[model samples]
Target: MERFYRRDFINTLSGVRNAHLLGTLSYKKVPNLGLFNSVTHIGATPPHLGFIMRPLTVPRQTYHNIKAQGHFTLNQVTLGTYQQAHQASAKYEVDEPEFEAVGLTPYFSETHRAPYVAESPIQIGLELAEEHHIKANGALFIVGKVVEIRLQSHLIADDGHIRMDAAQAVGVAGLDHYYRPEPIAQLPYPRPGQEDKILKPKNN
Candidate 1:
């Protein structure tokens, strides 16, 4: 495949991915925000999350800031803020903070120095735990331990599942496209003997 075609095809082939706004602060205390779709949960026991970042060949401010401060934020992108979130991806000068350039509000708390998106429905504070260099593509895999989470109370379900639809979280189809997801159905936990029983629809 051609370079442009291959890039788009490979990205969209993974289906919808959670879109997030990564917030970091430079050593000079400049706030930065970048849009990313590669964020994923790594573990639940210690509450870890990881994201893929482009190589350091160029000045990747996000990578630099995280390394300097050892803290960052992952803010969920929502329909209301998707456009502004996408705009944050634009390559800006080191002195230009995306939060200010893209017109998103930067929020700070006493516990973390990295700013969070005030518009985001869910904001997570993460402390840098580890970083691995991917030799194949020269990408960096950054892992962070979840330190704080801020969200609306109603979005949490009784079973502990977050109602993403209620939060209006948006997903990315590829590098540029954003989408909102709808819930189809909920399933019960699976077990050998309970497979058939669990498959049955619950009576409202």
Candidate 2:
């Protein structure tokens, strides 16, 4: 397969993933926002999250800023903001902040140095906890401990599960294609001898 086709095929092979705008601030206080689809839950006890950074052969401003400032924000992309979130991925100069260039509002909290996307329905603030360098590839794995989460109180269910469908969070396939996810079913924890209990979507 050709390079571009191979890239797209491999990227989209895993199907759709929740997308987010990662917010960082350079040492000079320049705010940066970049769309990312790699965020993953690391742990619950420690309340940790992680994301992968591409190979460092080229300049990676987000990695630099996270290292320099030791904090960052992950803002979930939604139906109304996916376009601007996607635009944040464009290559911008070091001094040029993507928040302004992409037309997203940036706000800050008193405790964290990183900026947050005001338009995002779910925003998470984290401090750099650990980093692992992949030897096979030059990619970096960044781990952060949750510092704060800002969002509407109602989006979370009584059991603490966040309702992504209610948030209208956007998902991405490959690099550019976006999608909306709808809840289909809710299932109880599997027990070997017990009959499965399931709740189907109301719309279904």
Give Cα-based local distance difference scores for all models. Answer: 0.91, 0.91
* lDDT digits (tens) for residues 152-172 of candidate 2: 999999999999999999999
TM-scores for candidates 1 onward, in order? 0.93, 0.93
Write down the TM-score for model 1: 0.93
Clash totals for all models, in order?
Answer: 0, 0
- The predictions' CA RMSDs to the true structure, in order, are 3.1, 2.9
lDDT of 2: 0.91
lDDT of 1: 0.91
Over the stretch 1-204, how does candidate 1's per-residue lDDT look in tens digits?
A: 999899999889989988999999988888899889999989999999999998888888888888888999999999999999988888888858678777899999889889999999899999999999999989989999999999989999999989999999999988997889999989666778875565555675
